[model samples]
Target chain A: MRLDLFAMALAVGLATWAFRYGPTRLNLSNMAPDSLLNRFLNATGPAAIATLFVASVLPYLEQAGGHEIPLALGTLAVLGGFAWRRSVVIATLCGAVVFGLASALV
Target chain B: MSAPADAPVTATPQPMGFRDGLTAALPIIVGYFPIAFSFGVSATRAGLTGGEAVMLSVVIYAGAAQFLALALVTSGAPLLVSAVTLIAMNLRHLLYGPALLRRAGKEASTRQAWAWAFGLTDEVFGAALGALARGKRFSEPMMFGLGLGAYAAWVSGTAVGALAGGGALAAYPALDAGLGFMLPALFLALLLSVLSRVQIPTIAVAAVATIAGTVWIDGTAGILCGMVAGALTGVLRRPHAS
Candidate 1:
């Protein structure tokens, strides 16, 4: 077990080092154009948002079943909290609380 | 050797230094610590030793897929199936690669690009992009510093949690179940922050489509279906000037 842990730790360090140094050795930055990179940059944010929506929200909605009440209530609480306080943490807490309470009550 | 001239600008100005990047990445590092701690706990519950759990995080470096693969493997799933599933789940990284390559390419060498690509995660990508959007050219060393900080937290967290035993994690049913919700909640929050009124309908439609598709397909495949749908929706929408 000790050997395995040591090996894993070594590998992690090596991987970090390689990732840190490898790009300097290869010089890829010059190969890609700034314009193309810009296009890619613009695309990534929406893509990431889409990916997150697909991966997380879609799954939650599916699990929520036919009754949209819990989801609706949760969304309202989250949005309302965010609107009132403009706080991500508060919005999340509101959603979680509403969801948990609705789950227990219903 | 110098900071890139054309890095994307952020709303708030950030100082271009290793110290600043470290400071910016601190929240994410702290956030990852406990989650990685849970992962370590879960890995040990599946009969892996501290070393094995740490190795999984180091090699895989993917959170959800790693946990899922570990669970599937310990549950007697065939090695091939587990391996394939893990690959499929992580295929999203392929998209992330090009995006990061473009942004970091200005200042980073080919070797550095490869390193950043390999080291990239949801948090790293978000933080780096957020930095870039602010017109900050993160020196390679700074990026490396941020990545390394998060990496250390993850591995150390796993090691510590594994050493602490899995029994305590199991005892807290709420925390255990809530673990699944954290990623989703974080993603939702991020999505909300990014979307404007114009994009809301597209997001809603894509999300609904994805939920509908998941009924027929299960597991990671459903996620792919939803992503495809969402991407299509995004493409169809008229481009907005940023």
Candidate 2:
């Protein structure tokens, strides 16, 4: 069940306090270094993120997409720009222009 | 000679004062505006009132998750599904917490950890952990500053986009079409940027599983399945620590 915003805030506050000075404590220093679980959890971040992005786009990709080529190329350019420039706003804007132009062509 | 190549480095990192952190967050703040503005514009067009749009941004405070929720809400998806989707999407945060907490070590106070958790978005984690991985010290205050900067940009951008672009965007069909790819493009960028910190084999497994799963399953569930499959592969591969 979802907690109301206020209740959620309160729970977080309590948890923070408990972790700070309560009998039950967390030792974050050496928290399961290089353990199996830790490694699995760690790998999941990128795995999940990548998978999620792909999944988000797959619905459109699976269909007989009308503007598939443009969308694919535009997204690729966006990723390239992001990796090269390391800025989301600029990369997307540039890619949007390409996407717009490519859509017009086909 | 850069201060003698073999000179002993300081054992502890100097505290990253607020100024440094804010400076670091500047790009992120600037980068967030357009996306948040786009979100605001879309939210209003999707039938949410301007106030509702702004409130959702403030309360949700999740980048992509907020969009997913908006889509689900507009489509009349069940509440449970929306909540589950968001949680599944954010499970990656679990991975971020350990890496960050480990870096923060004993220096992280409970108050600091709570605040950190509150503001730990993927971009923030990427920025902060990327720094830590590069040998810079992990300072909670710096992270807090970065979080605040990003948060302000997001909330304010939502307000502007909702109020300004909300009504105007209805006339621009081309704009909406272009904006449709924004999230996907963004995710692709993020995936690329984070690749350095991940193993190649893990990514391969994730990619194959995600692509295969999406063709079979639907929506966020496909991605979740891909994640599980990837993590299972990680177990088999014995996990590659960054």
Quick one: best lDDT, which candidate? 2
What number of clashing residue pairs does each candidate have, in the order they appear?
21, 0
lDDT of 2 by residue, B1-242 (tens): 12366877877666665566676778778878878888898888788777777776776676776776666666665566556555555555555565566675556544656665666666777677666776666676887787888888989999998888556755665666666666776666657656754456677777788776656765545555677777677666643344
Off by over 4 Å in 1: A1-106, B1-17, B46-48, B70-85, B88-111, B186-242
lDDT tens digits, residue span B133-155, model 1? 76776566666767777778878
Candidate 2, pairs of clashing residues: none
Provide DockQ values for all models, in the order shown: 0.16, 0.34
- Give per-residue CA lDDT, model 2, range A1-106, as digits (tens): 1243223323333332332223113443354646776666556666766776676577567668577887877887887787677765567665665676676576
TM-score of chain B of 2: 0.75
CA lDDT of A41 in candidate 1?
A: 30
Give lDDT for model 1.
0.58
TM-score of chain A of 2: 0.56
Question: Please, what is the whole-model Cα lDDT of each candidate in the order they appear?
Answer: 0.58, 0.66
